[model samples]
Each structure stands twice: as C-alpha cells, then as structure tokens.
Target: MDTITHTLFGLGIYKAINKENMSKREKQTLLFTAIGASQIPDIDVISQLWDTSGQYQMWHRGITHSLFLVPVWALLFFILNFFIFRLKSWRFFWIALLAVFIHDTSDVFNAWGTGYLEPFSNARLTFGTIPIIDFVIWFIFLLAFILSKKGSYKESSIYRISWIMIALHIIIQSIQGYALYKQYEPRYEQLALSASFLPWNYSVIGKDENTVDIIQDSLLTQKHLMYKLQSSDNSNLKKLFKQNPKAQTLYKWSPFVVVVDNEERLGIYDPRFYRKGQSFLFEFIEKTQK
Candidate 1:
C-alpha cells in the first residue's frame, strides 16, 4: 500500500481505541505510537544510499518488513514512549504491535510484495489481489470519518465499523481475483494476476511454450486479449544479467518476466507493470560491442 493509505490506517487504528478515561497527553502519545509504528518498516528505503549493486528493488520492502521484526519495532516504540510520555501502562506496547503488524501484513495483497519471512525465507509473497493504491479503501475510510463526525455515537465504534468494512472489501476482492486466476490456469503453463485499479477487474498474464498473453478481464464480461507476444529465442539471459546487474535483481524480485531479444537490444521486463508500449521495470543493453 502507499504512504497515504498506511497513514490513514494508522489514524483509524488510533481513533478506534477507547480513550474515555485517558488524559489529553496520553491520547497524544497514542497518536504518535500508531503513526510511527505503521511507517517504521519502510525504513529499508535508505539502503539505496549504500547499495552499490543496484539491488534497491530487493531492499525497499526487504527484511525490515519481516514478521520477526514486528516485535522489535514494537519494543523500540515502547521504550521511546516510556521516556517521552512517561506512561507506565502496557497499552502503548500493544497498540504499537498492532500498528506494525498491520503495516507488514497489508503489503502482501499487492503485486509488489514484501519479504515477510525474511531470515527464514527470501521469497517475495504477493497475492496480487488488490491494487497498490486502492480507491475503494480510501473511500470507505473517508466515508466513515465523515459519518463519525456527524453522529452522537462513540468515535471508536464508528472507526471499528470502518475497519470491518475494509476487511470485507478485501475478502471480496481476493475471491474475485482467485476465481479469475483459476480460469486461466488450465490453458497456460504459468500465470500471474494483477488487480486493476477498478474493482473486480484484473490483468492476467499467461505464458505457454512460446507465447505470452496479456488479458484484461472482469467478472462482469468476457476476457479481452490486450496483447499477445511471441517469446524471443535469441535472448542470452546470462549475458544480459552480467551486463545489467539490475536485470538480475529484477529477475529475482519478480514472480516472472518477459524476455526481450531482438536485432537492436537484449533485455527483460516484468510484465505486471507493462503499459502502453513499454514497461517501467525494463532494463536493456545495446547489442553492439562495448
């Protein structure tokens, strides 16, 4: 998910807490804990400064997002709040834990997955069931926020209801994505699904022996073939990897890639981000001698 979504989720979590008896200082500390814990995992972005190998693709959502690090982050926040807020309750630690856990787990639903298992496993676990920036989520939270302000009901009740609505939306989207993925499974040797920005819509990439099929599909209509590509036989992937280290890292980071080899160029690109005539994740090298 994007930063805005994460921050909103943090705010929602903070608002969901029952602070009827707490003082203004305690509530303020709670707000900081929720927001900070939600964003701590993204600290891995700084690794690019020291990563000369051009492996920032792998580093961005790497070990810092690991499940094992959730408690570590929570502990850090707990200690910080202890001195800064001078609050002696265990409630601060629990809220920090919830915030960090939500941050790590929410990332698994998108195409750009996180290394949730980290030291135990290096796999980038992605379901591709939801877009990185989902308008549905934003709308739900926004509506809940608006309603909560107008009502005489407790604010925590309103925010908790909003969380439930968000969960239901994710479940419905996941079910639709899984059904679409299974529909293309028998026909293709390998398949990947990327949820479109619109609800119940998906971009399905299917690869067979020598061709790749990119389909735009929705539950309401028949699948439409957007692009059909013939796999290149002349791609010397080892040479490409040697020439462009980023290509090697991309290959490792993504579930699959579309290899491009022609008279003018040799390269590979992740098909998930392929748009118009090119892909943003593409990396290539000139065929002529250096």
Candidate 2:
C-alpha cells in the first residue's frame, strides 16, 4: 500500500483504542507507538541510495517488511517509548506489535507484494485483491471520523466498527478476486492480477508461451481485452543483462515480463503496469547503428 494509506491505518488503530481513562502523556505515547511502527517497515526504501547493483527492486520491500522483523520493530519501539516517555507498560509493546504486523500483512494484498517470509523464503507473495490506494478504506476511516464528531457514539467504538468494515471489504474483494483468478487460470501458463481503483474490477494478465494478454473484467462485466503483447523469448538477453543490470533485476522482480526485441532496441517490461502505448516499468537498450 501507499504511504498515505499506511499512515491512515496507523491513525485508525490508534483511534480504535479506548483511551478515555488514560493520562494525557499516556495517550501521546500510544499515538507515537501506533504511527511509528506502522511506518517503520518502509525504512527499506532508503536502500535505493546505496543500491549499486540495481537490486533496489528486490531490496525495497525486502527483509525489513518480513514477518520475522515485526517483533524486532515492536521491541525497538517499546524500548524507545520507555526511554523517551519514561513508561514501562507492556501495552506499548503489544500495540507496536499489532501496528507492525498489520503493516507487513496488509502489503501482501497489493500487487507490489512483499517478502513476507524473508530469509525463510524470497517469494513476493501478492494477492492483488486490493489496490495500493483503496478509496474504500479511506471512506471507512472518513465515515468513522465524521460519526465520532457528529454522532453520540464513542470515538473508540466508531473507529472499531470502521476497522471491522475495512476487514469485511478486504475479505469480500479477495474472494471475488480469487474466483476471477481461478476462472481464467486454465487458459494460461502463468497469471497475475491487479485490482482497479473501483471495487470488484480487476486487470488480469495471462501468459501462454510468448504471448501475453491483458484483460479487464469483473464478476459483473464480461472480460474486455485491453492489450495483447508478444514476448521475444527467443532473444538472448545476456548482453542486455550485462549492459543494464537494472533490466535483469526487473526481469527477476516481476512475476512475468513482456520481452521486446525489435529493430530499435532490446527491452523487457512488466505487462501488469502497461498503460498508453508503453509501460512505466520498461527498461531497454538501444541498438548501436551499423
């Protein structure tokens, strides 16, 4: 998910807690614990600055977002809270754990995925059932905030109900996406899904040999072929990889790529992000003129 969505998740978690009886200082510390842990996993983005091998694609959502690191992040936050706020309650640790756990787990639902298992496994586990920026989740949080201000309900109760609604939305979306995936599973050797901004809509990418197809469909609508691409699997990418390391990293990082070997260049691009006449993730090297 994007930074804004993650930050909202942090605030939502903080608001869900019943802090009416807590001291002002305790509330401040709790808020920090929730938001801080939520944003901590994304610290891996800094690896780009030191990435000379073009492995930034694999390193961005790498080990730091692993489930194994959740407890470590929580512990760090717990200790920081102790020193800064002079508070030693285990509640901080538990809250931080929940925040970090949610941060790691939620990322798996997006197409970007994460290295959830990390050292145990290097797979980019992605469901692609949820968009990186889910307006539904934002709406839920906004509704809860408005209800807390306008209605007589307690703020904590409102936020808790919002969380429940968000979970239900994810569950429903995932179920639909899974069904859609299975519906088209038999047609291709490899398949990947990407959710649209609107709920219940998805873009499905399927590869059969060197042919790639991008179809937009939903349970309610018939499949529409958006783009059909051909991959130059026969082309030797050894020189391409040797010349541009990032291209090799991209080839490995993506679930699948549409290889381009034409008169002008040799390149590969992720079909999942195809738009207009090109893909944003495309990398290529122009041929030297004779």
Candidate 3:
C-alpha cells in the first residue's frame, strides 16, 4: 500500500511487540525502526531504471522482498546501525524483522503489488484493497506514531491498542476487496493483436463494481464499447466501417488512402514510459535546436 499505511503498520507491530518491553533507548529506536521498516521495501523504486520489459516487476520484487532476505537485510541494518541497534537483545531482532515483514504485508493492497512468496512463485498478487495513499490514515497514523515517539510515551497499552486497530482496519479492507471483486465481471480489453503496446498478462478495463471507481491522475480514462467487425465479407466490413463513426476517426490519422483489411482488428494506441532492462535505460535524446 501507500508508504503511510506501511509506516503505520510498522509502528503498530513495533508497539505490539514491545509491549512493556521498551527501554527509553529501545523505545526511541523502535519508533525509527518502525518508520523505516515500513517504507523500505519501496526501495524497489530504484529498480525503475531496471524495468526493462517490466521484468523488474517479476525479478526485483522477487528477491529483495523475499522471506529469506529479511534476516539478511536486518543483519545488514543491525551491523550498520551497531550503535543504534541493541543487537545483544533478541527482542530487538524480532521487532526489526516484524517491521520489515509488516511493510511487505501492507503491499498486497496496492496497484503495483509485489511477489510475497518470491523464489517460490512469481505471482504478483493484489486485492486492490485500498487506494495506495489514504490521507486520513496517513494523517492519523502520522500524528500517533510521531506523538508516541516525540513525547517518549512509555505506555505499553497504547501501543497494543494501536496494533489491534491496525489489524481491524486491514481486515475491513480485505472484506471490501472481496465484495467489490464479486460485484461484476471483469472484461479484459482485447487490443489489436499487433498493438505495439507490450502486453502485460491481461489489462482489465471494464469495472467489476459500480461503487468503486479506480482513481489515478484524472488524465486516465477508458472506453467500454469499441468498434468491431460485424462480418467476414469485405463488402459487409466496409459497410460497417462506414456506419461506425469511430472507424472514421481512426482512418483520419492515416494519410495512406489505404486499402483496409477486414481480417484485422483496429486499435487505439497510447505512448507510455517504461523502464528498460537493467543495463539500458530510457533516455530521451533531444533533437538539435531546429
């Protein structure tokens, strides 16, 4: 999910684990650890450069987000943060691992989901459980996590209670995801087979539920009904094209007063920026001043 929820999740888990166990120093460490642990998996963003063929979606999330990497990364932090991390205590290790795990767990809800069981399976799972960023959760958790750290509140119950709330909130989102998923059938838009658009497995466009509208930048839009072939005969195909206004729209873009083919499907295209394979990256070469 969004970094905010991820952070809250980390904080809640920290408080839950540290219940009655935090030293003044440990308490301070726990709060910072919680903040970092939650937001860190997003370290994957750096792989945006390595997104060639969108393999980063599969490969990057595959290794770094794995269960095996947890202790390895934790150890890296433990060693690096030697002064900050009280590694002599076993509890600190447990809380640190929990913080990272919670961050990964929160990812199951976002659009750009991750591979949790990586190295085992390549499933990029998601529930579309919540908007990546929810301002209310961000605001409330922001205040709660910060206040607890700033005031150095030592109360263990407050931390436990916060974790309970976090669990309940995630459970509610889980139910919403299921209910929304069941409301309608998903119609995967069939692009013209030759669409230069590199295909992701399936691009679902039609809504499965009326109540939920997927929100992104407002520039995002989609159409449900598209021009289609009505018959196999060229005579009928030509008639159909003449009847449909959208066909005229597509033809307008072509200067080749072209011969049209009836067997082929026509499609609209969009220019999208994507990451190149790890070694190569997208760099726009500017034209000389004209």
Candidate 4:
C-alpha cells in the first residue's frame, strides 16, 4: 500500500478509539503512537543512501517490515510515550502494536510485497490482490468520516464499520485475483499477478520457457493479451550480472523476471510492472561493451 493510505489507516485507528475520558496529553500520545507506528517500517528507504551494491530492491521492504520487528517497534513507541507524555496506560502499547501489525500485514496483499519473515526467509510474499493505491479503500474511509460527522452513530462505530468493509473488499479482490491466476497456472511454468487500479481487474504475467505473456484479466471479461515477449538466452549472464548487479538483486527479489538478450544488449525485468512498451524495472548492459 502507499504512504497516504497507511497514514489514513493510522488516522482512522486513532479516530475509532473511544476517548470520552482521555486527557489532552493522553490523546496526543495515542495519536503519535498510531501514526508513527504506521510509518516506521518504511524508514528502511534510507538504506538507499548506503546501497552501492544495488541491493536497495531487497533492502527497502526488508528487515524493518518483518513480523519479528513489529513487537520491537511497538515497545519503542511505548517507551517513547512513557517519557514524552508520562503515559501509563497499557492500552496505548496494544494500540501501537496493532498499528505496526497492520502496517506489515497489509503490505503482503500488494504486488511489491515485503520481507515479512525477513531473517528466517528471503521470500517476497505477495498476494497481488490489491493495487498499491486503491480508490475503493479511499471511498470507504471517506464515507466513514462523513458518517461520523453527520450521522447519529458514534465516530468509533462508524470507523469500525469501515474497517469491516475494507477487510471484505480485500477478500473479494483476493478471490478474484486467485481465480484469474489459476487460469494461467496450468499453462505457464511461472506466473505473477498485479492488480489493476480498477476493481476486479488484474494484469497476469505468465512465463513458459522463452516466451512471456502479459494479459489483462477479469471475471467479467475475456483475458486480453496486452504484451508478449520472447526471452533471450542467459548464456552470458556473467557479463550481464557484472554490469548490472541491480538486475541480479531484482532476479533474487522478484517471483520471476523476463530475460532480454538481443543484438544490442542483455538484461532482465519483472514483467508485472511492464507498461507502454517498457518496464519500470528493466536493467541492461550494452553488447558493445563486450
């Protein structure tokens, strides 16, 4: 999920809490706990400054996003609140824990995924069920906010209903994506899915031997081939890897990649991000260098 959505999640969580007897100091501590915990995992992006080996691809959503680190982050927040706000409420710690857990777990449903297991596993666990930016989620939360303002229902109750609706949306999208993925699973040696911004739509990348097919998939529509690629021999991977170590990292991080070896160059890219005749992740070395 995107930064804005995560921030909204934090705000929503804070708003959903019953604060009838809470002091101003207590409310401030809770607000910071929710927002900070939600954004903390993404602090790994700073690793890019020191990433000369091109491992930022693996490092960005790496250890910090791990499930093992959730409790660690929650403890840090709990201690910070203790010192800054003189907070003694154990409920504050639990709220921070929930915020951090939501941050890590929600990332798994998107195409970019995360190193949720980290040290125990290097796998980028992704469901590819939700787009990074989902308007459906935005709409649900916005509606909740509006209802909280004008409706007779309590603000916390409105937000709680919104959370339930959000979870249902994720489940529906996942089921749709899974159904589409199984369509190509039998035919392709490898498959990757990227959910479209539009609901119930997906981009399915299927690879078998030297060919890669990118298809627009949906339950209501027939699968449409958006792009087809032919993979080149990686026989000279030594040179390719030497020139673009990022490509190597991408290969290790991604579920699969489309290898490109042509008269001009050698490279590889994850087809899930393919668009407008090129991929955002392509890495290549000119053949002329050889």
Candidate 5:
C-alpha cells in the first residue's frame, strides 16, 4: 500500500484503542507508537543512496519489511518512547508490534509485494488483489472518521467497525481476483494479476511462450484484450545484462518479462505494468554500431 493508506491505518488503529481513562501523555505516546511503527519499515528507501549495483529494486521493500524485523522495530519504538516520554509501559511495545505487523502484512496484497520472509526466503509475496492505493479503504476510514464526529457513539467503536468493513472489502476483492487468476491459469505458462483502482476490476497479464497478453477484466463484464506483446525469448540477453546491470536485476526480480530484441535496442519489461505503448519498469540498452 501507499504512504497515505498506511498512515490512515495507523490512525484507525489508534482510534480503535479505548483511551477513556488514559492520561493525556499516554494518549500522545500511543499515537506516536501507532503512526511511527506503521512507517518504520519503509526506512529501507534510504538504501538508494548506496545502491551502486542497481539492486534498489530488491532492497526497497527487502529485509526491513520482513516479519522477523517487526519485533525489532517494536522494541526500538518502545525504547524511544521510554527515553522521550519517560513511559515504561509494555502497552507501547505491544501497540508498536501490531502497527508494524499491519504495515508489513498489508503490503503483500499489492502487486509490488515485499520480502515478507526475508533471510528465510527472498520471494516477493504479492497477491495483487488490492491496488497500491485503494479508494474503498480510504472511503471506509473517511466514513468512520465522519461518523465518529457526528454520532453519540464512542469513537473507538466507530473505528473498530471500520476495520471490520475494511477487512470484508479485502476478502471480497481477493476472492474475486483469485477466481480470475484460476480462470486464466490453464491458458498461460505464467500469470500476474493487478487490481484496478475501480473495485472488482483487474488487469491480468499472462505469458505463453514468447507472447504476452494483458487483459482488462471484471467479474461482471466481458474480458477485454488490452495489449498483445511479443517477447524475444530466444534472444541472448547476456550483452544486455552486461551493459545494464539494472536489466539483470529487473529480469530476476519480475516473475516474467517481455523481452525486446530489435535493431534499435535490446530490452526487457514487466508486462504487468505496461501502459501507453511502454512500461515504466523497462530496462534497455541501445544497439551499438560495429
């Protein structure tokens, strides 16, 4: 998920806590624990400064976002709260753990995925059932926030209900996405699904041999073929990978790539992100004259 969605998750978690008898300082500390831990995993973005090997793609959501690091992040936040706020309650540690866990787990549903197992496994566990920015989730949070302000009900109760709604939305979307994936399972040797920003819609990328198909589909609508891309699967990519290290990284990082070998260039791009006649995740080297 994106930064904004994660921040909202933090706020939702904080709001769900019953703070009726807590001191003002405790409330402030809890707020910090919730929001800080929610964002801490993304700290891996700084690796770009030292990323000379073009491994930034693998490092951005790498070990820092691992489940193994969740407890460490929680402990760090607990210690920070102790020194800064002079609070020693274990509640801070537990809250921080939940916040960080939610952050790491939520990212798996998006197409970009994360290294959830980390050192134990390097797989990018992506479901692609949820978009990076889900408007339905935003709407749930907004509705809960608005209702909390207007009703006589406790704010915690409102936020808790919102979390339930959010969970149900994810469940429904994932089931639909999984069904679509299974439907295309037999047709392609490799497949990837990316949920559309609009609900119940998806972009399905299926690669069979050297031909890649991108289909725009929905549970209720007829499947539309968006693009048919040809990949030069038989071409030797050694020169391309040697010339552009990022190309090598991209080739390994993506589930599959549409390889381009032509007079103009040698390139590879992930079909899942292809748009407007090009893909943002493409890596290429121009042909050199002899």
Candidate 6:
C-alpha cells in the first residue's frame, strides 16, 4: 500500500475513536501513532539478523502481533508520554491501543507476505484474493473525508460506520482466501505442474484435480505462466469454462514468462515492467516450500 493510503487509514482510525474529545496535539499524535504502530507486525521481517546466534526461535507472529500486544505497547506509550508530556497515563491507553491495533489489523489485508501472526508463527498468511489497493475501500474513505477542514469533519457517525464496514470486509477477505484454497487445494497435486511445490503460495488460485492457474496481466509481465492439468479432478475446470475461458491467459499470452525454460536467467514478476538484465530480481519459488 502507498504511504498516502497508510496516512488515510491512520486518519480514519483517529476519527473513529476520538469522535469529539481530543486536543489538536492528541489528534496529530494519533495519526502518527496509527501509521507507525500498524507497521509493527512487520518487525518479524527483520528479526533474523538480530537473532545473533541464529538459535533464536518462536512462532513468528505468536504474541507480539496478537490482541495481547495492544495494551503492552499502550502501557509503554502511556508511561513514555507521561514523562514526555506530563499527561495522564490512563488517558493515553486508548490512544496507544487504537494506534497499534489498527496498524496490525489494516496490514492483515496483504497476503501474509506480511506477518499477522508475529511472535506466534513465522508463516506469512495471505488471502491473495484481492489486489493490495482495493478501489472500493479507497473511494469510500476518500469521499467521506475532505482534504481541508469543513467544519467538524473531525467526527461523524457516517465515518464511524463506514470504517466498521470496511473492517468487516477485510475480515471476510481472509476467509474467502482460505476457502478458495480449501475448495481447490486437494486437487492441486494432480492438476498442477509436477514441479508444483507451493504454486498457491505466490498467488491464491485454488487448484482442481485437473488445473491450477493464477491470473495476472500478461501484457505487463511477459513470459512464463504457471498452469496445472489435473490428475483426475475436473469439477473446477467445468466451472472455469462456465465462468471465464480466458483463465491463465496471462502466461499463455507470453512465452517469455517461461522462467524455467531458461534456467540460467529467471523471468521475474516485473512490476512497472522492468526489462531483464537491468537488475536482479528473486522469488521464493514454490519448489522451496517445505
């Protein structure tokens, strides 16, 4: 997600809880806190070098990214704010919790490429069901809040309800992601490439016994498509044609997507369409999944 989106999300959170009772300083502080703390769950991405002996281990997102860390960071923030601003520790508690909780929760939308279970598990859980920047969410938040002050745009029931709905949608996204795989995963081995490891890991397109495919824009990324033919499963295939026949069209459109065909040089998922040999790009291939 873009920084602007993060800031907008933070602003949304600030509006929800503060409603009406907050100082200007408190408002600004909340905005900062939301953006900063929401990024906290990602701390696991960096835990490796800090591990010193490499023996350090635990469920990656187990605790720190859980419901438990909300108050812990709040207390730490409250205590810190007390010394820094001579403010009441009790008052700062909600501010801290709101900031941190929103941060972690907002991030859960990213396909577990970002950890939601940090300190509990290292698994990068993701739904891959929707694009990172959801247009529906973006439009709703953008239109509700004005760029400049329009009276007490500081708070509104509409804003509060709007956010509640967004949160619900995100939760549903996670479930939809899991369900997609549950419906198709059993058939993956038979339908997917023999080389198929965790084909579903990169992008979540559930497989049938006969086929597995992750759809993307091929005009943007030329070459190599990951496709699976079923060992026997054909149910999803029946549905696929019924829904859209152009499935897996991205890879089919571009032969250069064949990264394995030329093992010496890999065809990367090029965003902004970077040309090959300009810089090296890497992916955790499905083959590496354990």
For each candidate, the alpha-carbon lDDT, in order, equals 0.89, 0.93, 0.47, 0.91, 0.94, 0.46
How far does residue 283 in candidate 5 sit from its true spot (Å)? 1.0
All candidates: TM-score: 0.96, 0.98, 0.55, 0.97, 0.98, 0.56
- Show model 1 residue runs off by greater than 4 Å: none
Q: Supply the TM-score for candidate 2.
A: 0.98
Residue 16 error for model 5, in Å? 0.9
- The window of 10 residues in a row where model 1 has the poorest summed lDDT is 227-236
Candidate 6 lDDT over residue span 190-271, tens digit each: 1111111122222333334334354221222332543332222211233322233232222222111212213232222211
For model 4 the local lDDT of residue 155 reads 91
Encode model 4's per-residue lDDT on 1-290: one tens digit a residue: 89999999999899889888989998899899999999999999999889899899999888999999998999989899989998877888899899989989999999999999998999998989899999999999999988888969999989988999999999999999999898779999999899999999999988898889999989999889999998874556777888889989998988888888878878988888999989999888988985
lDDT of 5 at 154: 96
lDDT of 5: 0.94
Sorted on TM-score, best first, the list reads: 2, 5, 4, 1, 6, 3
Which parts of model 5 are misplaced by more than 4 Å? Answer: none
Cα deviation at 49, candidate 4, in Å, is 1.1
Per lDDT, what order, best first? Answer: 5, 2, 4, 1, 3, 6
What's the number of clashes in each of the models?
Answer: 0, 0, 2, 0, 0, 29
Of the two candidates 1 and 2, the one with more favorable TM-score, higher being better, is 2
Give the CA lDDT, 0 to 100, for residue 155 in model 3.
36
lDDT of 3: 0.47
Clashing pairs in 2: none
Better of 2 and 4 by lDDT: 2
Weakest ten-residue segment in model 2 by summed lDDT: 281-290
